[model samples]
Target: MAVPVESEAPGGRDVVGAVLKACMLLGQFSADRPVWTLNDLTTASGMNKTTVFRLMATLVQAGWVNRTDEGAYRVAMPVFEIGSAALAKLDIRSAAKPFMSDLATTFGNTAYLMVPAEQGAVCIDLLEGRNSLVVAGINVGSVMPYHAAAGPIVMLAHSKELRDRWIKPGLPAITEQTITDVNLLVEHLDEIEDAGYSLSVSDYLPGVAAVAAPILGSDGAVLASISVGGRAEEFEGAALAAKIEKVCAAGARITRIVRAMPRA
Candidate 1:
């Protein structure tokens, strides 16, 4: 019979190593390797086959892991459910939705809420305006390149560590308008940080123009970015200035809400 490895606390409360071992097993799964065989997990976890099997069985019973027909293990729906529940608890999205909708409607352009992820930015939410011509086909869950697009660039400009890590020796060009020169890109990032927002034309894709501003946390760190994107013609001259003003105002409102909320 398998037993949880336990240690006594100061008050004699038990600390179970088996639960931590099970968490370690789950932590092995990632975007690169989402599934694992019994032997694979056993080797990666450095736990014996019997212990791994017992832990896997317990996890399967709890609906945290699913055993495939091929005898492999993968994260189950319970994990996604837990993640979704946590996301639902975040007030930023809820607080920003009204302003995003109003901004999109007022400007007749797409408004996006982008958050940093793995050297890139992911669109967490979006509201499409009444414009018939779509500049980009991006939606929620779309990953934007860190080196391109207004939202991602603004995020990178604020996050020094992520910028240094992601910006390498050679910058890849997605479009002809994309900034391939590292020095030029660095200069642009500096301008963005000073101006408190980013405005770009055809930087990520042809015929697209965008303006973005950072949403700051209570500690004045970049929490995320809000961007408005549309056709190139709509982003020129006085129209561009109007868009910048509205986008910055919306960003400021969202930042204030984020700062007021208690950290989770």
Candidate 2:
């Protein structure tokens, strides 16, 4: 579980520390806590309050962030729009969208893009299913508690070592439905490992069902996962199996496409 935060001002000829610090400041905002005031940013970022304010002002001017009348900061819409457009052009997503879309349409299930976070998985983007019956309550950027969702397990199943390493620590209970005990979670992971996907009913939120498969990287390691979620009843027996198989196949396809492409 390495935390991959980007760009800490390279130690080369003439580094831009101020710019890098600002980037770090922006990155510090997490899913659990999105809104922050100048004081909060200054404390989290370890920069002076004046510097934090100035940086936030610059971000606001650039439409990357906004300040509420109450003086808390939030990510601005333009920044999200730019990021979404960029992801729309990512080759892996580009190639898999049609396939995933067809699968979602077939199952009428909500679909998501997930990547590994520090010992967890974070949903980055999502598409609501055509049917209202499919659960679309969780938004993009929601952090999936490792115990409940298919996406986390799918991404984790890539390495027994990685999974074993991550799962060893005590699991947290988000709801009464969450599996907090280590041995119980291991049993669930065993099935996930065997099946190449994870499926669960009402494991996180009551009445929410999900299936997820890992997206492997060029190194044959898990890079991300794609998942479909809905009501428990929708994912049972053959229906659940079909959804898992399609999503897992799509994940593998996306992985291969990513592996074939050269890194920037």
Candidate 3:
């Protein structure tokens, strides 16, 4: 039998080309384009038809991809399980759950735990409260931009890199209320950092409101954010004030927990 030689990735790192190809195929499936026929997938990936079929078949056998009755391909349940498992391993998520539950219960809104991502912030966990509607705003795994929502704003306010990216002129407005002006956004970020929390009204999503505070590591770096969000009307007056206080308290508590844990 002829032995196959491994390929070198950039920087002289040896990599399994087949595995990389499989991942490339998997990346094509997304929220907007969840299913793909073999022909379409081949064209979209710009890979040979036979290669696409073989990799997809391997993925199907491994339970990462599923073949539809009509011959289209979509991601399988195991992918979601793997994503959930990854989220579960984060110490911040484990530490913040109790506080998130309390915030949801107390405010009758939704409480969320978000971590900073390269593109923005990712909602890793969520608890819907007593008054949660059928469409209670963003879902778990939703990626929010640093310029828009409360959670990402906390991240942007705390991180110099994110702040630099955000202050660049002509950032797209997520909604009419989203701050697009660089000068005003700079002022807004300063206010959030000064107050130790962020409040947004109809910014990321219309008619939605949220308050969030940053969870900081011992070194003063932001590890994550805890937030509560609901209909804009609910976040007003003394009620809003109470929510802000609770959220900030939750964030502080989680920060303490994170600092005490042994670093991996």
Best by lDDT: 3
For candidate 2, what is the total of clashing residue pairs?
A: 0
Runs of candidate 3 with Cα error greater than 4 angstroms are 1-90, 134-137
lDDT of 1 by residue, 76-104 (tens): 99887775665556687887898889878
RMSD in angstroms, candidate 1? 18.3
- Candidate 2 residue pairs in backbone clash: none
| Candidate 1 residue pairs in backbone clash | none
Model 3: per-residue Cα lDDT over 189-260, one tens digit each:
998999999999989888889999999988888789999999999999999999998999899878866776
Q: RMSD of candidate 2 to the true fold?
A: 18.8
Which of candidates 2 and 3 reaches a greater lDDT?
3
The per-model lDDT (C-alpha) reads 0.83, 0.74, 0.85
